[model samples]
Target: MNREAFYKLTYGLYLVSSLRGEKKNGFVSNAVFQVTSNPPQIAVVCNKDNFTSQLIKDSKLFSISVLKKDANPKLFGLFGFKTGATVDKFESVKHITAKTGAPIVVEESLAWFDCELINTFDVGTHNIFVGQIIDSDLLDSESEPFLYSYYRDVKKGKAPKNAPTFIANK
Candidate 1:
């Protein structure tokens, strides 16, 4: 089985955030996708060890901030490479609390979605959280979405170990 085949699957980059009481956390994810259209449902996959995953489980809410093609590289370093356990990822970033109290990253975002947790599925190392779209808005009408391919092929970015698409170097 060639793991490289998985790389051919298209994915978009996003920031998935959630708030638990006073604590807020988020992470860079490429596993967010629409699961249904009739009831407007989407699913986001998070690693079990991720701080943001616990926040999402506790809050029963989350927000997806769609990154633009020209999104700042530092955003990835702050949210993707650094752990929210010791770092306040939102502290230095420009963001707003959604109606669901989840943080929506405004900087370099092309669109945003506030969601309410509807169901959860345990998938080994990751948990897939399916949510109903509560509210959403477009931030930039002209900007193109940031794709995972671009992140790798152009930006030469690497996925964190916790990411669902992460490939170990052998």
Candidate 2:
């Protein structure tokens, strides 16, 4: 199969956050989607090795902040490129803890979602978690929500090694 053709599959960039004990962790992700609407469900794919993934497993909750066009690329680089085990991802970032006590990103967010994990499917290198929406709100109206295509074509963003889109031969 031509995996690059999967590039046709669109995604929106987001700051996905969760907590374990007193430790909060977040990372950049584009693999999020709505699995259902009646009960309002979403599926988020995360690498099993990610610290944020570990936090999600422990906390059983997560927050997704949809990134805006004006959002700082540095924030994305920090969350997407740098590993939280080596550095504090939230040190320089401004955030607010939600009703779920999950941190939500305020910088350049178009919308946000706080979810409670309901199910999990182990998929080798990645784990797919399905959750029910606990909290959700829109942030911006005038500006557009930045698309993954824009991140690549406009910002020249490169897919990280752990990203689902990472291609072995490019």
RMSD of every candidate to native, in Å, equals 0.9, 1.2
lDDT of 1 by residue, 1-170 (tens): 99999989999999999988888789999999999998999999999999998899888999999999969999999999998999988889999989988889999999999999999999999999999999999999998999999999988999989998888981
For residue 23, model 1's alpha carbon misses the true position, in angstroms, by 1.3
Candidate 1 Cα lDDT to native: 0.93
> Which residue segments of model 1 deviate by more than 4 Å?
none
> Which regions of candidate 2 are displaced past 4 Å?
none
lDDT of 2 by residue, 13-104 (tens): 98999987777789889999999998999889999888899889988999999898857889878999998878888888888888788999
TM-score of each: 0.98, 0.95
Best by lDDT: 1
Q: Backbone clashes per model, in order?
A: 0, 0
Task: Write down the worst ten-residue block by lDDT for model 1.
Answer: 161-170
